[model samples]
Target: MCFLFLFSLPIDTSDRQKSLPYGTDPEYFKMPTRQHLQASSSSKVNTSAKYHEKDDISSDIDNELSVIFRTLQDLRNLKENSTVSPRTEQKSASEKLLKITELQAAIGDLKRRNAKQRIVKMPQKQN
Candidate 1:
């Protein structure tokens, strides 16, 4: 009975632990040294800053956005102040109009091709 009682008690770490061992758990050591997280009456810094602080965007991100904005402005200026002769503009416009007309004609041709047609055929099997 004494031998059974002595042997029944846990001998080593693996025999004792179910999920975690005796020394492996952080809470065991932390509980003794840890102070209460309750807010103090005269705290200088915010306590929430310890856990839930918002991350600041790096200066590199700001610089990248400024560069992208400058590039967009430059492209807008180029589009607004296009340098082309009046004759050249007229020629391009006429070419675009000709292309549009060709597209419209092609659409009409497709519509004609797709027009429904009736077909006469023998009756299907009666069975």
Candidate 2:
């Protein structure tokens, strides 16, 4: 069991030099050191200036939104002012209804006159 465990452990490659087919050293495959890893992880990036620039744009966006909302309100007011009053609409609707009823009565009179026509059959000559 101990021999199997020892064989399963990874072999150290400190003394061995890995050569490439082009005879160039592998610079990209070097393992990172503790100091290099810590230096990369501890670096602080300052973004306050970028955030302030975005804040200025946010204020401009808010101003534009307010202008759009005000324009919408003005359009609503204009539409309400240009529309006809309820009393005028009611009068026009009643006039249309009266015209429709008169047309329906005229149609009924024509239908009755059409029904009164007799279908006369002519006598055929003997062949």
On residues 10-110, what C-alpha lDDT tens digit does candidate 1 reach at each position?
77777444555546765764544223543352243565564324322123444544655665465445442269888877876686567557656655644
Task: List where candidate 1 sits over 4 angstroms from the true fold.
Answer: 1-81, 116-127
RMSD in order of candidates:
24.4, 33.6
lDDT, residue 87, candidate 2: 91
lDDT of each: 0.52, 0.58
The lowest-lDDT stretch of 10 consecutive residues in candidate 2 is 113-122
Candidate 2, number of clashes: 0
Candidate 1 TM-score versus the reference = 0.29
Each candidate's clash count: 0, 0
Best lDDT goes to which candidate?
2
| Candidate 2 accuracy as lDDT | 0.58
